[model samples]
Target: MEMVRELASKKAAVIFTKSSCCMCHSIKALFYELGASPTVHELDQDANGREIEWALRSLGCNPAVPAVFIGGQFVGSAKDVISLHLDGSLKQMLINAKAIWF
Candidate 1:
């Protein structure tokens, strides 16, 4: 989401994703299409990648493939991100997160 992008602009970001996840790929592509690049941390490739997975589990998140974060704040899954973008809420979230100027 916008908040995630803002945090990423300020510092390196970690998007915990899985290689086999379609939604995860979509999220990455969305960022690319928007001219935002996030350092993806594929969970299926590393055990520590499960940290976010565990957090999501604790937060009652579905055992999904894309659990994003910004400045250590959980930003939900790909659907949530895309939905925000569609609703124009992501822009403010990004501004509030300080990822975009204007």
Candidate 2:
């Protein structure tokens, strides 16, 4: 949990992902398209991956990989991200989180 919190607070936008997960790829692409350079943690390749995943689950994330955190807050899964984007709130969220300058 401490590691997860540290990583989350290390950047304005952070994503815990697995390399082979398509949803993770989609989310990464989404941040790129939005002009935000998010810090990505590839769980599959990390020594503490499983621990972090479990920590994320305890924090209320389901299927934890691809878990998104902005401004130290859990932003949910791909569905939630898409919804925020479609609703035009994602941009502001990024700005508020200090993830993007524009």
**What lDDT tens digits, residue by residue, belong to model 2 across residues 1-102?**
999999998899999999999999999999999999999999999999999999999987788878999998889888889899999998899999989986
Q: Report the C-alpha displacement of residue 38, candidate 2, in angstroms.
A: 0.3
Per-model tally of clashing residue pairs: 2, 0
Distance from true location, Cα of 70 in model 2, Å: 0.6
Query: What digit string (tens of lDDT, one per residue) describes model 1 on residues 1-65?
Result: 34333433454334668899998899888765654556787878976556646755675558656
Error of 1 at 12 (Å): 6.0
What C-alpha lDDT values do all the predictions have?
A: 0.65, 0.93
The worst-scoring run of ten residues by lDDT in candidate 1 lies at: 4-13
Question: Candidate 1 at 6: error in angstroms?
Answer: 16
Best by TM-score: 2
Q: Candidate 2 versus the native: TM-score?
A: 0.96
Q: Native-vs-model 1 lDDT?
A: 0.65
Best by lDDT: 2
**Alpha carbon deviation, residue 58, candidate 1 (Å):** 1.2
Off by over 4 Å in 2: none
Query: Candidate 1 deviates by what RMSD?
Result: 5.1
